[model samples]
Target: MQPKLPIQCPSCESSLSVTQLSCSNCSTSVSGNYTLPLLLQITEEEQNFILQFFLTSGSLKEMATQMGNSYPTVRNKLDDIINKINQLKTK
Candidate 1:
């Protein structure tokens, strides 16, 4: 499996910025400081939840059933993610 991107500093636990990117096929490299997208800045679990939400056609009931969680639980999870996204947008 591919390694996950490290978004936080290992020692300080602060957010990290992208410093370089490379083209896999051409071996071309680009270097610059850049912030990760809001979606990518979230935890992987949150990202997967968002993906699952879309895959289920944005149906909370379907998501709850698929996750073996109660409807309110799934709804709360979605609400939390939405709040996080909004907070990120303001920054």
Candidate 2:
């Protein structure tokens, strides 16, 4: 399996930069300082949540039902995710 790209440093919890990239087909490598886009910096769990939320037609009630979580809980999680994304944008 291909290793997933990291968007943050596990050690210090700082945003990660994509310094090197390679072509999978021909093994060509490129290196530079590159910042991970804010959207891409979102955690995998958040990504899954976004996907599921869209799949459920943006209905918090449906998300709660699908995840077996309370409606308020689902809403709160969504709010928190939105806050995090907004914070990233301000930086």
Candidate 3:
């Protein structure tokens, strides 16, 4: 049977290479450690907001309406989330 691909870090979408496994996938590579991006470390509320925005194909007007908030408010929240994600990449 074919083996499954290595697990990926939720934050960066990078593969997680473990050192070992009991099955035929043993002897995995042990390279640098994988760290989750700070954005992924953010509060669940923020993550959910971002997820919803993307699921709606980045429709800010729709997001604002669905969230019962002003356009500026939704825009600011999105900006904050983006800034946080950018910071993660810079690290």
Which one is best on TM-score? 1
Instruction: Output the lDDT of residue 24, model 2.
Output: 100
Candidate 2's C-alpha runs over 4 A off are none
C-alpha RMSD by candidate, in order: 1.0, 1.7, 8.1
lDDT of 3: 0.74
| lDDT (C-alpha) at residue 73 in model 2 | 100
lDDT to native, each model? 0.95, 0.92, 0.74
Residue by residue across 1-91, what tens digits does model 1's lDDT show?
9999988999999989999999999999999999998998899999999999999999999999999999999999999999999998998
Candidate 1: segments with Cα more than 4 A from true spot: none
Model 3 over residues 34-88: C-alpha lDDT tens digits?
5544544566788889888988899999999998999999999999988977876
Q: Rank the candidates by TM-score, best first.
A: 1, 2, 3
Candidate achieving higher lDDT, 2 or 3: 2
Q: Please estimate how well model 2 matches the true structure, expressed as its whole-model Cα lDDT.
A: 0.92
**Could you arrange the candidates by lDDT from highest to lowest?**
1, 2, 3
Which candidate, 1 or 2, would have the higher lDDT against the true structure? 1
Models 1 onward score TM values of 0.93, 0.84, 0.59
Deviation in Å, model 1, residue 85 alpha carbon: 0.8
